[model samples]
Target chain A: MAEPGREIPKPTPETQHFWDGCKQGELLLQTCKSCDHTYFPPRPFCPDCGHREVAVVKATGRARLFSYIINHLPTPGFEVPFAIAVVELDEGPRMMANILECEQTPEALVLDMPLEVTFQPVSDDISLPQFKPASQSTGSGSA
Target chain B: MGQKTVAIVGAAETTELGKIPHMSQIQLHADAALNALADAGLTIKDIDGVATAAHNPVELAHYLGITPTWADGTSVGGCSFMLHVRHAMAAIEAGLCTTVLITHGESGRSWVGRHGPSLFPSELQMQFERPFGVSRPPNMFTIPVLRYMKDHDLSVETLAMVSVIQREWAAKNPRASFKDPITVDDVLNSKMIAYPFRLLMCCLVTDGGGALILTKADRAKDFPTKPVYILGSGESVESPMISQMADFTSSRAFKVSGTKAFETSGISHADVDHLMIYDAFAHLPIYGLEDLGFVKPGEAGDFIAERNTAPGGTLPLNTNGGGLSYMHSGMYGMYALQEGVRQMRGIAPAQVEGAEISVVHGVGGMFSASGTIVLTNSE
Candidate 1:
């Protein structure tokens, strides 16, 4: 069927952890101990080293603002004029995330700007992970 | 082990794409099939096999009126139907079947619409990515595109150049969605669909049906249609989903798919007279150019600006206006094949003169699934 409205897909057992971390305002990536390869969208095994010994690691939550957009037209479920980004996470997974606490424009945003993870509550079962300019979260607001 | 010479003897289509709310999916399929049969001057009874794509294959068989000696519903993104041509060639050479009709019919934009089940991973892809407002393909693909821009030092204006040129090429095509004039400023100023990406930078959602008829080279001459021989074809799947991708800078499947196609066709980049790339979005052609070795990695944006992919330009690309302009029809790959066949036959609206060789590339997924087909008419 043609998607009628803004429909968000639900997380399954395999992806619950990733979603959970986002709910709590943390960016978490799965790392496999067998070969030490980290990845996003959480998988069951180490795709590269082929190991099953994997665990969720608290990401440094630090990232570089690789790219982003400020959307104007809102999907049925989303607010309009929100910011989105492809954050290069410290754990090695470059994730598609939202950038909150800032205007959605090239002038206010700079490439490779340091960013840190934050959370926005969306629903009872869903909490979302967004990023803020790293300086704001650090309190010093410099460098 | 060696190459083959299969040609396009038939082509067909139905009405406009999206939400007709009138005809059943099978009716659309049959209409395209019937048109192809007429295009090739052949009858349904002349075919020995059928290939189906989109929502349901068995349903297609039920509606088509007759069963084939060989049947396929191989679904790979939209371009999969074109990949079927190569498989059909192999099957024909193996004496399994002849006169294969490969088709796809879907209307995901509006009435009588269809989208195959999200297939588990995408369900999670939508969930984990969206609530944070990482919704839709433009947002999903932005991160990698960002990485591409940063690592390569590509400016947003450079990226905009790709779509702008494509829109210009699409202007000649009556089937295209955004034939209106567009400028780099227009693309830059356009509202953002995702970060650093705007509406003009994306492809439109259209609804329609398309078909291709192929058979042995010897039998093709007898067919009423002009034959555009299929030289080589290849397919590849690098990742199941975008989230699973390790690198954001390049598409491994595109590289590998083109490699396989060139091997099968025994043609090189130099042999190509035109390139009918699948441009689901502007970046797609850029990726195809790099992945298929038309340009060095990170050089496509510059190539588009400095080179001519437009009419009267050095490069005769997407003469039918491409997917960016041509009907999106769910899978733009099928239409690309149609354009390639037309170009080789010298019958396209914006025909590429003396164009004997062409390359039609199709990508599925988010740089995750890809296929490449090389075609020529040396004879």
Candidate 2:
């Protein structure tokens, strides 16, 4: 699961759909049919009401800035000054995605800021679903 | 049955929190052990009992320069310390040993190379959740909170109130990582780290060392000015793996442990004045309040926010500051017992008023293992 330039864990069968969707440039989640409650990582069963029927759905790809950290540690392949956010997907599930394309500071990470999903192609097969300001679009500068 | 009362006589700690790369975990545990023995008015040579949770067994005893005839390390993670305290009390009352020492230290934060190759043990790591990019503690916790919101028909506003209450509690203690006054609005509007959880709800990632000493009730009185008594104890592990748990929405271990502890102490939750439930994440206390029977199952979010668990509130809790504001050392269970002792002695700076009886509970490995100890002033 080593992407030539990336050092993240490889996705397995249970998590492949999530990675595949990210590869296709979409944010996805699993919803339980019995309870109709949305969840993350697309589990095999409805976590609520003990139902086995679950379905995959594209998220509105819209999220609210839930909470975040201003990391100063210099890890290779990742920006030292990066903002990692837990985004509240419009569908009800919350996912951990980084907030990119914005000032990498505390001021840029106000709670409830509107955001849109963006993917970073770590390896050819896997692209992590990160987010950035909704007003922003796909441009080149990363850091 | 000889004497059903026990209390902490000493507590000690080392400063290697967050990232300590220079020494083995054993060496770090030793430093804290020596400090605690000194605090208890005893030397390492005087300690004949050793207890720990999930260690390499002789690692702690060998490092401390004392090999007790009795040794135990149950390794339940953060909750291990409180469980060790209860075990020490039982061993002392049975005359198995005198002057026991408990310790823990781990470089969990720094030892593992992120992205390169995770050094975290395969069995111990979050195998089920981490692969989907849900590697952090705050993310896993968000799921339960989402369900709690549904079960109670509560708004996100209810959860926001918890951050403010804990921030206020943290403000009173210098040890907490966050001390400024935060508001419900600030928390609700704050950045989401995970759905249903905000930045303020997460415990700061810290790696540190802590140790405590226990002696026979009479031996405790001989040295320390106020040796707190351990009134009652209880422990139960419902599920080994978090994902396999039957009820992810509510914690079963906390409920069982709290109920058993209340029964062991011959009193109800109503008799308890100070409540120190683990706050590994902010939602922990919310789940804890319900499990410990303080509030109904779905009332924790609101119960905590209305000042029900603050310094001057009805349940005045976690006076030394919790993992939320204080230190989130690898194993903080023992420190919880130490805080209980301090509160009962009226020595805590954030002391709950008239605190004679306190209920201290610990949650280990997410919501898997739970333990409780009731400590009170010597009657």
Candidate 3:
């Protein structure tokens, strides 16, 4: 469900496939075919090796809390005291997202804690990628 | 130290800072420009080059009735003004223009003739980060500090000390927005704007602007005001997205910029008597100190805690009370440059006696961009 007043991302030609993957419950990443370099936020060319040939890969949806802040002020559609976090995907890229299913405190949102990606559909064309604590059954991979 | 020496012959802030509902943004720029012109005994007709950020240089030139042969509208973020000074120095050296005027103005608080946030849906920040509820600077800029603290074993009290010591400097400056003294407890107990960042740790939202006039060192003596020579300067950018910053604990942009400035200036850390690191947030100075090689990594918090940067300390920092207590009209790089000039001229309210060399460092956006300038009163 889309949160009222929250911004909806409009996809560009390069990022359309990534957004398309999100709508179908998959997190997509781009990898360079020439240099085998991986990157995010969807660009046509590889940033590392400047290669034109790239491949789209599925992210494991598993991540770890890298860093964050518990914002107390209210913004457009966000409730006060929410955790604005940066999570490191197991594949090596880090992205910003909001933490869910946890208390908005340093004690609860410990750094390096295990997390898993969960998509929240904000619009028909866009679905925001968020994170939540990894379940007990989800075996540890990296932290 | 180029072929031609460039010096700042005039520098002044707006007639009034904090709040000015009567003046629009461009008017604030004009007011500061006129004040600086009057200080240097020059006029708009005398200026052959112009530079500014946020607002277009062409618009500013037209607004001020200056038909400049050279103009720069390099707007990166808050540190845009620092880049302006660096660019102006090179322009003057290359004989691109005889005299250069760099102006900065923003309606951060009063919203006088200011545009609202223009968030493009296709922009990287808007597309990836904004949807996650990272709204304002306090939330975004403060995100990496916790990781820094955790790595350094820095306590919250040490972080609060940054606000406390800067407040002490602000107490000395009558023009500072908040003059009252504050304790570490006070900062800790203040309203929580973001985790690990209290209200006092954040910069003030005010409306103001400043301007600088630079000319060849040979013509610098013709001005009424003393000249502060630009010895060296450097600028660099890392990443626009805060999450993608090379490292959460330190800024890659700060390191590159500071290193280049030091290399160009050929000055050692011990030679610097005064420093001005843009304190948009408390952690910036800590990062600035380490990245600038003033101190080792993970030691800035303790260095600040031990009163190394306070009044009567070995090294003075943010002598203008900084953005935390001083006025912050969005782009804070102008104010930092203004204070550096003041220190060089021996006229700052909290002046460092016989301070010959001053280094001013600034950060734009969320550690996304950086610029450093080395200023000296001695030729």
Rank ordering of all candidates by lDDT, starting from the highest: 3, 1, 2
Whichever of 1 and 2 has more TM-score, that candidate is 1
Candidate 2 or 1, higher lDDT? 1
**Candidate 3 residue lDDT tens string, B1-379:** 4232889999999999999989999999999999999988998899999999888799899999999989998877888888998898888778899899999888888998876531112288878988888878899999888888878898999999999999999999989999999999999999999988999999999999999999999888888877898888899988878988979989999999999999888889999999999998999999999999999999999999999999999999999999999899989999999999999999999999999999999998889899999999987
Which regions of candidate 2 are displaced past 4 Å? A1-143, B1-5, B15-24, B107-128
TM-score of chain B of 2: 0.90
lDDT for B145 in candidate 2 is 56
Q: Residue A38 deviation, candidate 1, in Å?
A: 2.0
Over A5-94, each residue of candidate 3 has an lDDT whose tens digit, in order, gives 988888888889999999999999999999988898789999998999999999999999988999898888888888899999999999
Per-residue lDDT of A52-109 in model 2, one digit per residue for the tens? Answer: 8888888877777755544443334554455545666676666656677888676766
Strongest candidate by DockQ: 3
Can you give the lDDT of residue B159 in candidate 3? 91
Error of 2 at B364 (Å): 0.8
Ranking by TM-score: 3, 1, 2
Q: Pairs clashing in candidate 3?
A: none
lDDT of 1 by residue, B269-293 (tens): 7778999778777777777888888
lDDT (10s digit) by residue, model 2, range B1-379: 1144555777866654556677556666776777777777788888888887656558667766787878887776678877888888888878898778888765556643222221123332232233334344554445455445655766777776666676777787766666888777887776666555666666666655678788777666776657777778789886544444446457888888888888888877678888888887777887888888888878888777677777678788776667766667555676677678778878776877777888889998768788998888746
Off by over 4 Å in 3: B1-4, B117-122
Worst 10 residues of 3 chain A by lDDT: A134-143
User: Local distance difference test, per candidate?
Assistant: 0.73, 0.69, 0.90
